[model samples]
Target: MSIVFEPVRGRPNSGGRLTVGTLYYGDARYPIRIEDRALAHLKIVILTKLRRNESFALSWEKKPADGSGRGTVWIHPALSFHFEFSGSKEPEINMAWLEKMSESANRTLGLRIDDEPREGEADPAAARAGV
Candidate 1:
């Protein structure tokens, strides 16, 4: 089954900007459980493209046992969007991963979501760039 992540416009606070969102699967909607840092990174990537009137595909691998290979969605600026957060605090952003994901979104093949970033992982474009 495909899931939809809706971005919520959060209120500003003394600490920093907060972004909260939700993940919708099937008939159920759940408050996004992603780390605030990662969620923020995704927000920037998505909004940047949308603001530029760019449309791109976002793909994520499916659970192996689910028998589905991957899930993808076409994101566009004209579409209605929202981001909602359940908490008041924000997590530290991971600049490396954000950069990697942003690069992937710019590639001809489109963005492909992978496991959360880890130390020493090769640059995401290395494989696609044939370097």
Candidate 2:
């Protein structure tokens, strides 16, 4: 049997900034809407743990529009993940966000999408380089 997940509301096709992408898991039957920029960074951290053969639970709080609940999934190396981006260009990454997320993924509760750290904590090298 397959489970289907629909977005809380239809996304507009205004091009560029209006598009919302999907992260498909569980044999592509389960779909989660995520912005390209955030999803890109998430993919990096998730893949790292999976590459090490680690299995963990990933939980996310649902938005108010999405019924205001929570969802959790057990991610294992055996499962597949397909990230479908709506835009052609890749978004810039924040190293500090990656570091914070990596730390969370290592914890007992597993990965939770955390907010990006404030300035000065973003990237030490990039900051020094005046980027």
Q: RMSDs, each prediction? A: 7.8, 5.9
Best model per lDDT: 2
* Ten-residue region with minimum lDDT total, candidate 2: 1-10
Model 2 stretches astray by more than 4 angstroms: 1-19, 122-131
Alpha carbon lDDT at 33, candidate 2: 75
Residue 76 CA displacement from its true place in model 1, Å: 0.8
Candidate 2 RMSD to the real structure: 5.9
Q: Extract clashing residue pairs from model 2.
A: none
lDDT of 1 by residue, 22-121 (tens): 5432233323233345456677888899899998876665455545465666777766655545556665555557777788999877875444566566
Best by TM-score: 2
C-alpha lDDT of all candidate models, in order: 0.58, 0.69
